[model samples]
Target: MSEVITDVPTEAPSEWARHHAVPTREAYRRTLLDMARLDPRIFCVDSDMGGLEDGFGQELPDQYVNVGIAEANLMGVSAGLAHSGLLPYANTISSFAASRAAEQVKIDVAGNNLPVRIVVTHAGVSAGHYGPTHHALEDIALIRPLPHMTLVVPCDAAETEAAVRATADLPGPLFLRLGRARTPMVNTEPYEFRLGEARLLREGEDVTLVATGPYPVVMALEAADLLARQGRSARVLNMHTIKPLDVAALGRAARETGGLVTVEDHVRIGGLGAAVCEAVAEDHPCPVRRIGVPDAYLDFVAGERSLLEHVGVSPERIAEAACDIVGRRG
Candidate 1:
């Protein structure tokens, strides 16, 4: 069994621990740096977002280039690098990288099916204090519809590191959605990273909680535990990959569980929730309750946890939703 955090610390010993229990972004940078050292074709283009002293920018100056806050140009430049037989990884905020540079991304990268890795940070509402514009709640909706686009959202730091390394050989345009803040480690045990396979974190029968991204997956696990306490069996699936979803796992969950509850940091319209519903409805036809951000946007900025709770995707709410779904099965 994976090492479950038995004692939840009320007070964090350090500020770094408080904000970043597991530093996913830092892990991404470090992994990229290590990979770049071995691969001569590895190059990085940043939209004035990557920290100067981190990753490619500082360590490998020749392989890194900053496009001065221009998202569209960033994609364009990365496309050029890809055309020159270089494996380029583009770094930028999720909203700007997806929405601000949509046209360029479609034409320059995805259109030609270039082997470029577009690693987007601050995905979903993880950009809490930055509010709606920075909160990429619709990034999955935007990228998943494009042809040749592969979307991967890692659940935690370990998965993020594994996913980054896994993208090295993956073909076509890959969109990696990464959260802004620290999250608790979920995949503590060693496991192989597959592009389209979903990991079953916990097994049960009464209900299934399918979730992606760090916070939502953790919430789903907590919800499963809560359901267990009430004598209900709830399974948890860490659906790390958003595109090319693990349909086989979804079918199994539907066959075994009473229903499925999809939890995500993005809106219910076109993220993990919609993807789960789409697959299950056509293949298995199971009852699915989509728990996430509603149709409206958060106008004001707040802390990540507070913003998530305000939008009603909190762990407590997820547990309640699971209870409702399982209760209706009777």
Candidate 2:
């Protein structure tokens, strides 16, 4: 389990530096191909997504399996492959993988504690125009409770690649939640990444903004900058790992910062915000504000950005929530 964990300053460049957004899904596709080249035991099973199948299938056809819309069967086969001493990566849409194939995931994957990596794309509302059926609002809620299921939400393409590489030898069920949007590289500089350890992007005392997933993290950094303009010092934490719940970082933020603001692209109920509140409630209780999609289904919106705005999880909304929390505490 080789891991790269380093800290870099998240500050604006003096000159005009181009920071390109990397799609985590695309990163996963590339990383998978690279890993498979060295490790023959690594097998990729897709539920008709065709990206992995097209990319790796051309080179290593024997190591690729396309289950053709049968998401449940995809999990079952991946579990079987894992049992046969093969590392299986099951790829599909988040909603289908977490909801449609949930039973197989629970009994076959997590229950057995197999080394199966369930890589899901279009998580949360990143599916854009696909609407609710495709939107994976409760993926964390559904997967978090399962025994031995390690949940991860990478902040960007680079982190996603590092996560996929790091989890190669982790001998248990893992879920990698990814967005479809091309999120800007928040950690443009090289940094070390550790499983279950929260990365503090910026240090401040006014308020703490904890974010998960790709777009939410980018938005969190933006929200932090927005707060800075108004004379509020905001700390940003990219909580990529959700299941382990970095309670130490959570406790420190609560103790040092004025208040806490958790941002996630998922539903507000059992998402990142809920996880942060759960951790803080026991050790360090504070004015914890949660920003995410509401409990109701997003019926009025169509595109991803519109749906996110409707739920008040946009950058501006998150900044307002942080300011409001700081103001109330003051």
Candidate 3:
């Protein structure tokens, strides 16, 4: 039998190449489409792109519904589907899906605790070339505050597939953040993946870098390289599942590292950093650094690289922050 592990590409690594298979967000949609093939009860609602780029409509046309460009109506319709005992997966850009449909998600989805899965594509700096309007820097912060919402940001396509499978088991409002670009898969070793459980990618003793989404892979790479250069290691944790934060692992890292640095392709406020602070500050107080887009929108004319560097969330910036935090502790 052809094994799934053997299917992975066997190639040489370059100095600065990311081994990105499928974009995590697209993989989620593809997996969902495959699941829909057998489960006739599955329905997908698109916010224009579903029929266009996502290709979800191509697989299951009868179960697919497009709500034009009206996001509110789309959420309302999806919630209604969930209430009627139909599992609905809504697809849209991250910003529009979360912030634009905030009320609908809070009321129709969260308020009712319905089994409506919201899959956000082209999230964060991955949409950088498209400009800040398309960048979903605040989506994570916005969605975390809502009740009955399981916030997730899968690190890679494989984990994304695992996340989709997990979503099928859980029955409630789930927000899965996915990027438009191909991201490097960090987890080659298999584990029992689940939503709301944090995955520890790398171990260290100096400091802890708690990151979510595709950015965490970059964080791991940065930490590894930086540790080799400085002869000091930093632990990195992939807090993919944000809602039910793995406080146990977080507590362990906090005790081990003493210093915490959170990297996210999100807002500095109400995002992964804030969540870490809330979790860490509950009993023990430690110095924490939050890395993400600041308060102001990137209205300035710039590409994705510029936007991230300007906001100081780039890999280099993350390394610098880690170095600074580690240096200060000495």
Candidate 4:
């Protein structure tokens, strides 16, 4: 088990938090590289992901393995490495890692309870131009049910770095979902990132906005701002850890806020929205509205921003959904 750090920072937001300069993948690579350099036991197993070749591959050739296009083999090799007492960070696209090599991930990693970090990039609709084939629409749903698996979806590059460092020595399988595009930093102010614990971004009394991933959290914050202007105090919770969810936080929201709205970049059926509804229904039932992609294939070609907008995962749409949920209470 990883040690939980609960020391929250009390300083003002930094200037780096105001910029959207670093891609989450880049942060993951840099942090992985730094850790690998200090610890020779850390190995990086890749599946034709070219971004790590220059830094990780060249700097530590013996510690890197490119399995070439075979995602199942990638997981298998990583599991083998873990069995030999070495920590491995398996690299692949989110769609392939969750779909093609899912069986290996479930059995080889999760079943054996190995400490394999499955760091997948291009999560959800981040690979928008690649069509539905590359989109990780159902990854959270597929991985959430597996035993001994820890799911984490960081909101930005800074949080991605914090998550990588925090979960480095975690015991058991981990799924770290990351996006391909550069995203603005959400943790501008000092904050504590505890595994399986939800971070409270903003406090409100009317409704709570729960979200994960980079863009969804940004949209949630924007929605909270919009709601504040309209006399609706909206609370924002960055539910970064999907599996082993912060149920206690949900209970508090249900009791205090009375209503909730969940936002995610994936489909509504089995992603963050579904998880939130499932948790709140049995424990503390409240009026909840989910804002996410519909249950269907997106056949159109567009950029990440365009696809997210079409799926109604925007600030305007999230704010509207929050209003609807709050209005139902009145």
Candidate 5:
């Protein structure tokens, strides 16, 4: 269904996506393989869960270690590998990879500034039916305060792949957030996704929608539908990377659009909303609407649909928030 890629494609996000063969996790794995091939010292330490669609369990047996159910050991071993000079990527569910092993991550990865990259899967409500145990709703908050760490939340499969490729050579600790569902592949068509740069999906004068990670698709579609029905134009910005935010873009949007709305799957407090507020508050002060989970744990939902609806992250909610922000309510 998806074509394989040896190198990044040269097409635009508006063009047909040429390569989608690799899912986000496998994309990270492929990057790891590339690094491992280039230097024999590169290693990957996985929890029992790295049972990917194409498991690299055997091909790189010596370079791979699958520790069963022990998230803490994965952090410790990854730190040890980093201390010994082999760049390692530790893999697990985001909640466990970050929260369950916060001390090890703080002491070993952040405290020591290890070159270990933590690839967290099933981030946000994308975990769907796995319930609260698997839903990593607070992962961004958990990793935000750590020092010497680079935080990234990629928009689609392409950005995820690029983030993986980029983190391979980056110094110090890095945390890559990924989704569980087959999110829209709109971002696959080559955008210039530098480390902390944000991409402007649309330009508008009425209002701006700053969306991050997988939820940008929701916001983009909502903005388009709103434009069609009410002629209420909305600018959508893709803020994949959470930390080191694009203050210039925020300034332009604040000056141009005059109002703002931030949509993300993570909690409202230490995420994209907070980052946007900090930037927009300085030069162009505007009314900011944050669309995300509030200060409460998400309840168990039947599926992703019920999950998003329960927490109000659906496209309709986003459109409503956009309209409310611009005073366009019918």
Candidate 6:
């Protein structure tokens, strides 16, 4: 079991404990509900998503709005609420939010520079059991290019809460990605979560494993351990914030490590891998290998773990990629 962090309050519930695992969406819900109680401007807007059913809707009825399955209108209504000086947390599935409501998100929220927090759940292939239609393989590709958009993919429940609380007062639009199931805790010790800052999880010299999202980050850590057994030092970086890419950290990794293997649940086209490649290519030249879903859509449906393994995002694959990079550099 992982040790609990000192930074988290003693009086905090067990869910906040570093070792205790919880769903990222649950953390978002609890944190948002607490914030809503203190701030009158905060509102929970759901598009047939049941995130606010626990308390935000039942206890604080006035602060919650259910738009009933309309993803586009969800963005429009949230944007309108933001325009009226209200902080709206729009909850929806990642696939629908990015695909169906792409226009509203691009125009209504990002274009106007509204402070609407688009909290999308079931990010990446976490909802793979529901098939390709539910998989959010291209969400980052669709939303990352929008102007004034802050895209964040938190690693676990703890970081998800931190991101939600940290970005409460942030300017412009925000896209917060979350997974559907509970995940292992990435940070077992006290650490500061600064937006757009890459948190170095493990130190190494041979290669760097930069990853985002819950499973990817976990797999990166595991891969680092696997590499250690083989006398290979693999640096692990939890790149929670994708949009404002941490070039300083990447630069250091490129210069010091000489190679980087980016891991993510999304596609390699415009997701975290692409972002890292673009940053390193322009500033610090290095061998950056991307381990993510291919450009083609998955035709068959399967469990999240099965899908992840099929796409070569497991700890074994990540470790092998790191070893290959280290060998090539030698």
Q: Relative to the unseen true structure, what is the C-alpha lDDT of residue 177 in candidate 5, on a scale of 0 to 100?
A: 85
lDDT of 5 by residue, 1-330 (tens): 122344543333223232563456555665566557667777778787745323455667777787777989999999999989888878888989878999999998899988989988888877777778888878888897899888888876677767776667788999998876566665645656688877888777788888887665555556556765787788888887777678888888888775788888788887778878878887778888888877787766656546766777776777777778778433
User: In candidate 4, where is summed lDDT lowest over 10 consecutive residues?
Assistant: 1-10
- What TM-score would every model get versus the actual structure? 0.92, 0.92, 0.89, 0.93, 0.88, 0.95
lDDT of 5 at 237: 83
> Where in model 1 is the C-alpha error above 4 Å?
1-20, 52-54
Alpha-carbon lDDT, every model: 0.83, 0.85, 0.78, 0.88, 0.75, 0.89
Clashes (N, CA, C under 3 Å) per candidate? 0, 6, 0, 0, 0, 0
Worst 10 residues of 1 by lDDT: 1-10
The residue pairs that clash in candidate 5, if any, are: none
Tens digit of per-residue lDDT, candidate 2, span 1-330:
111111212242111112435577776776787788889999999888855655778889999999889999999999999999999999999999889999999999999999999999889988867666788999998899899999999987778877887888998999999988676777666667799999999999999999998778878998988989999999999999998889999999999988899988888888888888889999899998899988886765476667787778888988898888888888
Identify the superior model by lDDT, candidate 1 or candidate 5.
Answer: 1
lDDT of 4: 0.88
Candidate maximizing lDDT: 6
Residue 33 displacement (Å), model 2: 0.7
Decide which is better by TM-score, 1 or 4: 4
Worst 10 residues of 3 by lDDT: 9-18
Best by TM-score: 6
Error of 3 at 206 (Å): 0.9
Stretches of candidate 4 off by over 4 Å are 1-20
Alpha-carbon RMSD, each predicted model: 6.0, 5.9, 5.4, 5.5, 4.0, 3.9
Q: Answer with 1 or 6, whichever has the higher TM-score.
A: 6
**Against the correct fold, how does model 6 do in TM-score?**
0.95
Clashes of 6: 0
- For model 4, how does the per-residue alpha-carbon lDDT over 111-219 read when each residue is reduced to its tens digit? 9999999999989999898787889989999999999999999998778878998899898999999998787788765566799999999999999999999989999
